[model samples]
Target: MNQLEQLKKYTKVVIDSGDIENITHYTPYDATTNPSLVLKAIQMKKYEYLLQKSINYAKKKGGLKNQIVTNATDKIIVSIGAEILKKIPGVVSSEVDSRLSFNTEKSIKKAKKLISLYEVEFGIDRSRILIKLASTWECIQAAKKLEQEGIHCNLTLLFSFAQARACAESKVFLISPFVGRISDWYSINYSSNKYRSSLDPGVQSVKKIYEYYKKHDYKTIIMGASFRNIKQVLSLSGCDCLTISPELLSILQAKNKLITKKLFIPKKIYAKPIKKLSHSEFLWLHNQDPMAVEKLSQGIRQFGTDQYLLEEIVTKNM
Candidate 1:
């Protein structure tokens, strides 16, 4: 079996792309999309039809320009996700606005709206969707409420142990620890050679989180994501899931090397029962992790910018 076939035996493979065409080729179990991916896919001629359908759907609502543009952007995301769901058997994570990462109430409201679109507009069931949110304390709190309401969540841009701890405490459906982004930070501030080993900083982050959850028997899933290379993807071979780009997926499919499982459930639990993080503690711990603090903020700003660019495209067609 090729590496992709071999890896599937250990990890649930999720395709991280907005291009429905590419998603079908990988046959990934799940699909994930963010503002940046959606923006990139929207510009493609193949996905141009999705933009038109979204514009028409937005126009029917008959709102002001800003509201119409916002509605259109949401429609495009849901529409593409809805299409990807038809090809993949598992859930598709549709992200909420990154700008709402700091607002708990607004974040909850937006998440519900995205769910409604998938269920009501696209005729897709809520069970087949994972509402993607930033791993902010506010976003985690919102996910806690939504999970209680039977709305599962996939927290993204996660960097620190504090974020992982909070998500596990909240019992969110999944937490996507960005393996590649962590490696990038360390490579820039420190040295690339430092992380050249299999024990890449990004890979180490997921391993730590996975060990924590497994040792405690936490039910929340840990989905390692944002891989910059195939090494990062294969490094977390036994993770609950790994959201991989199509480029890396293709490379894995071509390689015949058999890979061993790198992570596993610990035979003995090391830590005692851990206390849940309070809001203040969560913030303080996250602040102390300079890498987490910088990356989380930078990721949100980047996503927000892509969302704005997507809206500009919609406004032009309007």
Candidate 2:
């Protein structure tokens, strides 16, 4: 069996892409998309139609300029997500506006609105979606409320164990701990050639979180995301889930090699519940971790900028 086939024996492969055409080849179990990816898709001629349809949708709504643009943006993302959902048997994750990442109330409202759009416009059920949110303290709280309403969540831009622990405590459905970004952080701040996949800081971060989750019997699925290479993917073979890009997915598909699992939850670790992170504790801990502080803020900025650029595209096309 090829690497992907062998890897699937232990982990579910989720395609992290906004381009629907490319996703069908892998037969991924689930799919994930973010503002940056959605922005990239809107520029492609093949996916441009989804953008146009969203503009038409916004115009039909006949709202004020700001509201229309916001409506169009959400519609376009769901437009792509709806298309992706049709192709994948599992759920498709779609993120809310990054600008609202910190506002718990707004985040909750946006999630509900997105869910409403999926149900009303696309006829997709809530179960078929994972409302992707940033791992902000407030956003997690928003998810706490959203989860109660039966809306599942996938927390993205996660860089630290604090984020993972909090998400697990909240009973979140899944948390995407970015492997590549954590590696990138170490590469910039503290580089070392000795860092192979086994020693890679990013790989170690996910491993730590995975072990903690298993030790505690946390219900949240640990989905490793933002892989820099196939080695990182191979290193995380036994993860609960791994959301991979098409580039690496194809590489795994082509490599006819056996993949040994690198991660295994300890057979015996005393299981105990973790206390939830309070607002002050969350702030100090989040600020305490230089990498998480940098990456989380950096990720939100990049996504927000991409979202604005996408809005620009919608206005220009209309």
CA displacement after TM-score superposition, residue 85 of candidate 2 (Å)? 0.9
> What are the RMSD figures for all models against the true structure?
1.2, 1.1
Put down candidate 2 lDDT per residue, 103-165, tens digits, no spaces.
999999999999999999989999999999999998999998999999999999999778887
Instruction: Provide the TM-score for each candidate, comma-separated.
Output: 0.98, 0.98
lDDT of 1 by residue, 195-310 (tens): 66377999998999999899988989999999998888888999999999999999999999979999999998756778899999999999999999999999999999999999
Candidate 1 positional error at 181, Å: 0.6
**Leading candidate by lDDT:** 1
Where model 2 places Cα greater than 4 Å from the true spot, the runs are 192-194
- What global local distance difference test value does model 2 have? 0.91
Identify the runs in model 1 with alpha carbons over 4 angstroms from their true place. 192-194, 269-272
